[model samples]
Every structure is written in C-alpha cells, then in structure tokens.
Target chain A: MQFPSLEYLIFFPLAVAAWYAAAPRLRWAVLIGAGAAFLALASPTHFAFAFVLSLVNYFAGLALERWAETRKALWVLLATLAFDVGVLGLFKYGNAVLAGFAQLEALFGVAAPPRVLSLVLPLGISYYSFQLIGYLLEVYWGRQPAARHLGHFAATILFFPKLVAGPIERPHHFLAQLAAPKPFDPADVTAGLKLLGWGLFKKCVIADRIAFVIGPIFGHPRDFSGLPLAAAIALYTVQVYCDFSGYTDVALGSARVLGLELAPNFNHPFSARSVTDFWRRWHISLSSWTNDYIYRPLSMVISFHTSWRRVGTVFSILVTFGVLGLWHGATWNFVLFGLLHGAAVSVEALTSRARTRLLGRLPARVADRLNNVVTVVFYSLSCVLFRANSISDALYILGHAFVGIGHAAPIGAKRMFGRQYHILLLGLVFGALVLGRWWTRRRPVAARPTWQRWPVYYAVIAAIVILGLFQVNQFVYVQF
Target chain B: MTPEAILLEVNKVFAEVFGNPSITVGPTTTAKDVPEWDSLNHTALIAAVEKHFQIKFSLREVMRFQNVGDMCALVRAKTGG
Candidate 1:
C-alpha cells in the first residue's frame, strides 16, 4: 500500500498493535504473517513471486553453506545468482526487450512474433533479488553463515517496510537483527514517530508541492525558456531527494518503532562538495553495494590486465556506474545518466591532487564555496538526463538552459503554491531548505531537549497541514 | 614473516603507492586513519603489497581486510611465517 493512503494509515497501526501484542517468540510469525498479508493485499502475483524466490534462496543459501570451500559451492553460488538475475530480467526488462524486437522487425520488414506471456513486475523484485544475491555471495565466500531458520530468512527478504523501496539491507546486518528481535521501547517509539512525521512533511509538503511545477516544465521542455527550465531542473533535484529520502526516513522510523534497525540510505547529499563526495552521501546503501560487489571486484580484475592502476580504476568506475544506471530501468536515458556520473566521478578521482593543490592556494571558505557550486551545477545538469523524456529532449533542454538568461519572465509560483499563498509558500520552502541543512549538521533531532525540539516539530506539522498536497504520488524510487 | 616484518614491508608499499614518503602504518591502522587511502588508491596499495610480498590475495581476502592488522595476519599466514 502507498504510505500516505488511508488504507496504509489503518493497516500500519493494526499491524504494529498485533505485532506487539504477540509473545516475543511469536513476533517473527507476526512479522511474517503481516508481510504476507501486505503482499497479498497489494498483489497476489507479487506475493507468489516473493514467496517462490524466498524459498529458492533459502535452500540455495543452505546448499552453499553445506558445500562451502568446494567446487560445488561455487556452482551453487553462481546458479543462485543466475536465477535471481534471470527472474529480475524477465520481469523488469521483458516488455522492453519485446518492444525493441518489434522495432527491429519493422526495420528489417520481417513478420512480428506472436505475443509472449505478459509479465507483471513483482514489487520489490529488484531490491530483494539483490539482497538474496548478496546473501548467497556472502555464504559462498564464508563472510556470513547461511541462515538456519527458514522463517527468519524469508522475513529478511520480504520485510514489508523496506521491501517496496530499500536501503537494501545486507545479510550480515539485517539477519543479526532478526535473530534477536527487541521488545518495544518507549523512547524508540517516540523517536520513530518524530522521524516518521518529518518524513511525511518532506514528502507531502516539499516534494509534492514542487512536483506541480516540475511536471509541466519537464513534460514540455520546448515551451519554456532559460530560467523556467533551470528552475524545473533544480526543483526536480530537490523533489527527488525529498521523495526518496522521505520514503527512507519513514521506512527506517517504522522499523525502529518495531525495534529493528534498517541501514541508512541518504546522508545530506546536497552538502557534498564534489561528485565523489556526492556518491558517498547520496543513496548510500546502493552505492556501497555496487562498490563492494561490482566495482571492487571489477577493479581487481582490471588491475591484472593494466599496468596503470588509474586507468583500471577509471574503467571500473564507468562500467560499475553504467550497470548501476541500467539498474534504474531498461532505458537509454538511464544508461546515459549513469555514464555521466561515472565520467564525472572518474574526472574527480583523476584530478584530486590537482584540485587539492588549487584549493590550497585559495582561502578555505572560497575553495569550499567554489567546490560546492561546481558539484551542485554538475549534478543538476546530469539530472536533466535522469528527468527528461529522452536523451534528445535532455540535450535540447541543456543546450537552451543558459541561452536566454535574464531575458525571460520569472517562472511564476502560482501553480505550485496557489495564487494567494505563493510568496508565503516560497518563503517557507526556502526557509525549510536552509533549516534542513542546519538541522542535519546537528545531532539527531530526537536527542534534542523537548523545549528546543517541540516548536520545530509543531512547525513542521503545521506546515504540512497547511501546505501538503496529500496526493497519492508514489515515491520516484519505487519504480526502480 | 612476522607481523612486524610484514608491517615494515606494508608501510613501504603504502608510502610508494600513496606517494607520501613520511607515511607509516601499524597493525591497527585503518583506511579512515589515512587521508590519501581512498578506494582508487586502495587497489594500488593491495597490488603493491602483493608484488612486494610475492603473495596474491583472493578477492574475498582482499575485501575482508578491515585494518592493517588483518592484512599483516594474512600476509604472515600466506608466507608461512
């Protein structure tokens, strides 16, 4: 169910209540049942898909553990990984491949093939598949033991909170929490509620409001001129951050309320001063996963072939990010998005020493501001590919972004904030952005004195109530 | 093959790979402890160590090293010290 919907509003409280009411030993059963119910409620097809994959991976993990240190274990690991990737490919890319084949047939004047079985993408397939693949690899490499309990293993893959869109919990971290579920703590509950509220405010107030303006400009980029286009791109950058990170906050907070800890995903990414630093902070879990599983191993292999280590590192970064981009979807634009980032990161790595030397010559504050501006502009421009309808469209917009600067009319804020409250809303958004940066720099808000924190909390709640769109817009990351 | 002996070689590799002659690493030193020891430089350091010590590390072995101490232990074990 969508996070902001009435159904989820009712379902979450009931699920939480039932979970706590159960005996500690049976809590796992409660979680498993709840997860199954959620999947079934969402889609029986998704429920079947998740269940089958979980069962397959469960046995695969055991077999890998049983045959560890043998050639058989290697085969088991490869087989399980293939199955996971195969399932993901068939469900996620099956339609895209079909469409591509149709275009090829038209080009060659060949008869089209008959219709294939239509596939519905199982929710969380990309995320859970990666989790299972990581689990199998860990077991094969003897990094972590295969989970003995089938229920816990299934729960790890199908846990409802993070299943939809993830911080992509690793086996080592997530399984440990499942092994010993904690009892309800009042402080945990309070902290979780605060985080949940903040996340909701970000989603409903900031992201959804921004989407109203972003939709038209990006949808018809040819119609708008320089400033409006730039504003759309910049707003899109903020909107995506709020939407995805807002989802993560709610997921983490909900898990915390249940006394489980999910891995953190975002880390104030906009504060990053360089492209490399941006990757370090943004979508932290996914980047780390790719770093460990894809980039590091690929770099090692590349190192065997190349004498110049920098070339190998740069090549590996590009390939790894290319794959990461493809992970977003089976689209050419996504591929470009990933490659752009890859190139940017490679440049940053290659020029680190030179950049450091240059920065050393400047004042610290000047250097910091310059770096931040460069990073932000580079990333915002790259996101043009991410948000555009096609690569050509993205290029057109990028080509025109700075063309008519200072000559165009201000992109009015009426559609985004309503005619009466445009100025007020704009001021609030700007204020929130500034305060968000300052707040993140401090300790966790939950840890602050109530006298200091309550006012901020109430203000956020009030803002959300006054300005929230309350539309059922799925988070941008969910499609991935 | 002793930890101390391996660490001396490791320290040299670190200095050469990172281009900092003053650099020194002990058993407990981690990546975070060194300013220049980022992901790109890390692979180079591993390669330099392997070439110097005449021991190749498995991918898992390379990934599992948490600190210089772990690397020293692996080197010692592989060299049959």
Candidate 2:
C-alpha cells in the first residue's frame, strides 16, 4: 500500500507497536518480515525478487570484502554488478526494447503479432539497485565493512518505509543504525510526526490538488496554447517537487518514528544559485550517488588517461547526465531532460571563472539575485520537458505557450483555475513554507521539538484531512 | 618519503595547479577549503599530482581521498621513497 493510503495508516501504527515490543536482537527480523509482507501485499513477485536480491547482495558484500584487492574481488564485483544491473536494465528498458522491435517489424512490413512483450518494473528497483552497487563498492574500497548480519543487511535495503521509494540508503549510514537500533525516544516520534504532517500538507494539500487542475492541459498539450499551457507548465514544477519531496519526508519521518534516521533526499532546491547548485540540492541522494559512483570515477579516469582533459570532463558530464536522464525513463523527453541539464552545467563550468570576474563588478547581492532567477527559470522550463507525454508534446507546449502573445483569455483562466481559488491561497502558504524551509529544518524536528510550535503542526495535519484532495494520483516518483 | 614530506610536495602541486602560490594546505584541507579549486578541477589537480609523483592511482584510491592528508598518505605509500 502507498504511504498515504488508509491501509498504510492502519498498518504503520500496529507495526510501530510490534517493533518496540520485539526484543532488540530480533528487531531486524521484525523489519524484514514487515517489509516482506508489505511488498508481498503490493506484489508477491516483487517481494520474492527483492528477497532474492537482498540475499545475493548480502553474500556479495561479504564475499567482496573477503577477497578485497584480489582478482577474486574483481570477479565478485563484476558478478553482482551484472546481476543487479542486468535485471534492473531488463525491466527498466523492457518497454523501449519492445517498441524498437515493433518499429523495425513495421519497417520490414512483417506482421509482428500484437507486440505484447512487457515487464512490470518493481518499485524502487533503480533505488535499491544503486544502493546495492554502492554498498558493494564501499566494501570493496574498504570505506566500510561488509555487513555481518544477514537480517540487518536485508532490513537496511528492504525496510518497508523505504522499500517502495527511497532516500536510497548508503550502507555506511543506514547499516550502522540497523546494526545497533537506537533506544526508543519520544523526540524521534515528535520529529517524525512533524515531518509526516508537513509532507502530507505538501502532497495531499498542494501537489495532488494542482494535478487535477492541470490534468487535461498536460494530457493533451495540442488542445490549448498561450497562457493556459504556460501556467500549467509552471504549476507542474511546483506539483512534482511537492509530490516527490513530500514522499521523501513521509519515508524519512516513518523511519525516524521507528528509531532510525534515513538520509534526506532534498534540500531547498529552488534556493540554488546555479544549475550545478540546483543538482546539488535536487534529489540530493540520487545526485550525490551519480556524482560519487558515476561522474567522478568516469571523469577522473577519462582525465587521467586522455590527452584532452577538458574535453573529457565535458564528455563525462554529458554521458553521466545522459545516464541520469535515461534512468528516469526510456523516453526521448527524459533523454533531453538529462542532456539539457548536463549541457547547462557544462556551460556554467566552462564560463564560471570569466562569469565570476564579470559579475564581480556588479553588486554582490544583484549577482546573487540574478543567478537565482536564471537558475529557477531554467529548471521551470525544463519541467515542461519532464512532464510532457512525449518529446513532440513537450516541444509543442514549449513552442505554443507564448504563441498568442497579446490575447487575454479569461475563459482559459477559468477552466485552468476552475473555482479553486482557495488552492491558490494554499500555494501561497506552501511558498511561505518553502521560503522558511531553511529555518524550519534547522530548529524544529530537534529533540522533543519546540512545544510552542505544536499548534501549527496540528493545524497542517488537520487541514490535510479536511482540505486534501485524496486519491488524486499516486506519488509521481512512485513508479520510478 | 614521509607523509609530512609528501604533504609539502602536495602543497606545492596545489599552488601550481590552482595558480595561487600563497595556498597552503593542512591535513584537514579539503576541496571546500581550496576555493580556487573545486570538484570541477579536482581530477586535473589529481592528474598533476600523479605526474609530479610519477605514480598512478587506482579509481578506488581516487574515490577514497577525502582531504589533503589522504592524498599525502597515498602518495607516500605509492612512491615508497
């Protein structure tokens, strides 16, 4: 069941009770059992697959450590990489592969019977696969020891809270806590509940509500143009951030309530000053993962081995982002999304020194303000590419959003907002929350929390139930 | 070479690569501390170090370097002078 669902609401409390009641030594088993049941309830095939993966990687991490720096180390690393990446790639790209075959058969005028090959990619496959690879690499590098307890290792990756979507646990981070689960603390619960409440505010109250308003405009971009299209595109950026980061907060909060801390997945991404800085803040776990495991190694090797180091760095940026984009989906739009960011960051890198010197002449605050606006606008438009159904649709929305330049259309505005003026007020409050995020994160959610602020929390949680548009859609990142 | 001695060598390489002769790095000096050099030029700096020391570092060694101290230790171990 989804984190915000009624079933999960009932299940979470009972699981938390069972967790604390269980003996400390058996806590790992309790987590794994709960996670297994959760995944099995969602899809038994996925549960079985995740169980097998956890077992394989548990042994793989151990074996790699045992044979570290030997030829055997290479073999173990390659084997696990093959297994994890192979299966992940098969499901992740399975539809794209079938689509290619269908196109080829059409070209040849051969009747390919109904093009029925499809694979259901398990939820969090990309997340866990990356985590597994990172875990093995860390053990292989001696950054951390291979986890000794099989149950703890499984629990670390498959914990029910993170099993479906993730903050993508690092072995050194999550495994340490699982190895020695913390004693029960009311502070953890308070902090967790606070995050849970705010996340629901963002998800149910803002993102889901907005998704309905913009549904048809995105569903068929060809239908409308000008302001309606432009507005929908802008709203999409807000919707997605709320949906995904909202999902992350719930995941992290749930884990916190259970007496473990998961790594945070987002910062105030909109506060970033550059495209590069934007990546540093957005989907922080995934960005850092790609940086540490993919980008750095690839760029370093390319720079070290090649005569053209600068060229290699650019190439690596493109390739790394291409992989990042492809990771989102096998669609051309996603590919463009990755390359667009990659290329933008590359331009920023190459011109940064000169740009810094040029901007130095300007007042520092002006330069800072300019950078923030430029960065936000870049990602805001990129949101058009990300949410569109296909590349052509994205291009159409982008081309036509400003086409009818001087025309004022109240009817278009009416259909777009559609008597949901209150939602606009909610958006304003969310904007305030986003503006105060730096403050909120720093002070509240600490040990026991600030009791004075409890009412605000209660109001948000209460508002979610009262005003939230439930069942609007699944969390946008859930399928990924 | 001792790690301390290698740290001196690394300091020189940092100055040359970053083109800032005044730069001096302690054990705790990280990429953040060296404002002139960030992750963008990190590999280039590393390549300079490899050339100066006349020793190659594995990808694992590159990934593990957290600070100037880690770089010095790796250099000392690699050069074995």
Cα lDDT for residue A342, model 2? 96
* Tens digits of lDDT, candidate 2, A261-283: 88888888998999999998999
Local error of candidate 1 at residue B74 (angstroms): 2.0
Model 2's TM-score against the true structure: 0.93
What is the i-RMS of every prediction?
A: 1.6, 1.2
Over A100-132, each residue of candidate 1 has an lDDT whose tens digit, in order, gives: 888888899988775565877899888888888
Which candidate gets the maximum DockQ versus the true structure? Answer: 2
* Best candidate (score: lDDT): 2
lDDT of 2 at A251: 92
Off by over 4 Å in 2: A105-111, A404-452, B35-37
- Which residue runs does candidate 1 get wrong by more than 4 Å? A113-117, A305-308, A406-424, A432-452
Give the TM-score (vs. native) of candidate 1.
0.93
